[model samples]
Target: MVNTKYARVLDHPESSIRWDQESPLTMTVETREGEIETRYGRFVGGPADGVEVVEIDTGVMRVVVLPTRGMSIWKIESKGIRFGFDSPIAGPIHPSLVPIDDPSGLGFLEGFDELVVRCGLESNGAPEHDEHGNLVYPVHGRIANLPADALSIEYDEASGRLELIGEVMEARWFAKRLRLKSRLRVRAGSYRVYLLDDVTNELSKPATMQLLYHINIGSPVLDDGAVLEAPIEELAPRDELSAGEIDEWNQFGAPQDNYVERVYFTKLCVDDSNETTTMVRSGDGSCGLAVTHNVNHLPYFILWKNTAAKSDGYVVGMEPATNFPNKRSFETEQDRLVTIEPGETKSFRLSLLPLINEQAVNKTSERIKSLSETFEATVHRQPKAGWSDMS
Candidate 1:
């Protein structure tokens, strides 16, 4: 059996090693199924300049992780298919270039081009202003824009398991002190990627937090006739525009000019193990993507559809989050926010599986159908009271 190996790529508080593309750090290991390789490098120019990335090749899949940007996933490539949207903004824009604190509170969009990005530690929703009209929290919070303080790669050749670990801290004087420890894991020859995250309250006082995983997909997998399948317990349109087309909430169409976005909030049914699966399949049901997470940890789900012109970001989001992406004040009033005392930690787990063939897609769809049979779904044509800001 081959032994396990570990390498530290960055340690902000200790080491001062500056990484760049000129000379990258690389590692390779042979597994029973195939070779697993990892490369650590920095982007050279453009909006992504100076950003550090770690690319992992698990034989069957290629994933890029951005250590310089809260360890968010840049993209995933499986069987010649890319699972990412073509954002108008040429990103992975460096965090330095993102004006996250702009008065408009929409500065987060400046660097919003990732297949998977975390939205929280404190807040993860619309921007909120105080009674005095001063911005209290910016859009989507600040977790995604924060860089990891430490990063490491661990590989177990015997089991063909590889893990990219990162630690990001969101702390300041007289403010919330939180730390996010994230691990992205994959196995040799596997199309599924797993994420495990732990948010810890490092301060001596109690803290409130919110977290949401914004998983976006586009193009080939999100074109006309694509559909979202989930064992939904309850579903509600986020607004009147979305309510008007509630019947088409699960369906996708060809990109259209001047297309408006719609959002659906839902509570998903869980299996015996408290796990739930949500999928987006191609028009012919030939291939797709699946997101699986435990409902116990993430009780709410949000579907964001923006099928605008291709150049204007024709994409969809399958988000499994702790709560709906409402303003922090609103979520807190609804008791959807999480609170942790000093030295406390809360954990979350999720997996992404790329369906590379027709059989895989069909199998996943069947599983969701079976789950659906166990629970009756409630579909609300309009925004449900207590679930939406407008409501």
Candidate 2:
């Protein structure tokens, strides 16, 4: 029988053993399926200097995880198909370089180029300011900018499961104290990557929170005529600009100059097990990517289409969130905020499957179609009240 192995990659409080390219820490283990390799290293130059990265090669897929960026997934590649956007922002940028608290409160975009990034711990959505115009919460919260306090790797040879774990704390004096523990798992010879996250309240008093997973894709997997398919139960445009093309919400077009973004908020239909899947496929249906999650935890989804010029960031975002990405005050008004008592924890799970061929893409498309056939989806031509700020 095979055994489970564990290794400590980083412990900021206990040691300063950070790895660089010249001397990266790597571990390879033999499993029944094949060989699994994990490497830990830090970027040395450019905007990504001092950024810690963990890369896992599962034979079928390769995933790059950023421990210094709230355990976000930088990129994923399987069978020569890359799954990430090419943003103008040359990142994995170090948190120090991002002015999250700038005057305009839009500094969060300075480093937002990840394939998957978490959007909460305290407040998410739009930036918030007080009556005096003082910034209270920066855009998309602070979790993405907070570095992990500890990181480790675990491998179960028998099951051929490999996992990278990280812990990030978002705490302060006289305010909310939350901890995010994230685990990224992959199995040898599999084209799927799984994420398990636990957000815990560490304060003596109860606290409220918001969370959203910003999963983005661009280029090859998201080209002209590409389509987004999901079992949407209820759907509404985010604003009037988006409402103009509500009929074509699921469709994508070629990148254009001066293209404005369109957003759609949706409540999805789930299966008997409370699970649902969303997918984006190439124009010819030759390749695609799918996201699977449990609806019991993530009750809302947002589709962001920004098909701008290549140099201006041509990308689409498939977000599964606890609540809509509105201002904290607006979300609170709509009663979309989540509250946790002291010592309590909330868990979230998500999986990404790369459809490497036409057959795989068709199979997943049929599954979504079957699920959607269960109910007639409601499509709102305009932004709906209580769901959109403009409404």
Q: What is the C-alpha local distance difference test score of each model?
A: 0.87, 0.87
For model 1, residues 1-391, the per-residue Cα lDDT tens digits are 3232333322112212233333223688787767888877766656777788888889888898888999999888888888888887857888999999998889999999888999997899999998888888899999999999668778888888889889999988988899999999999988899999999999999999999999999878988999999998999999999999998899999999999999999998888899989999989887799999987778999999999999999999999999999899999999999988999999999999988789999999888888889678999999999999976
Number of clashing pairs, model 1? 0
TM-score, every prediction: 0.93, 0.94
TM-score of 2: 0.94
Instruction: Give a tens-digit lDDT track for model 2, residues 105-196.
Output: 89999999899999987887989899999999899999999999668778899989988889999999989889999999899888899999
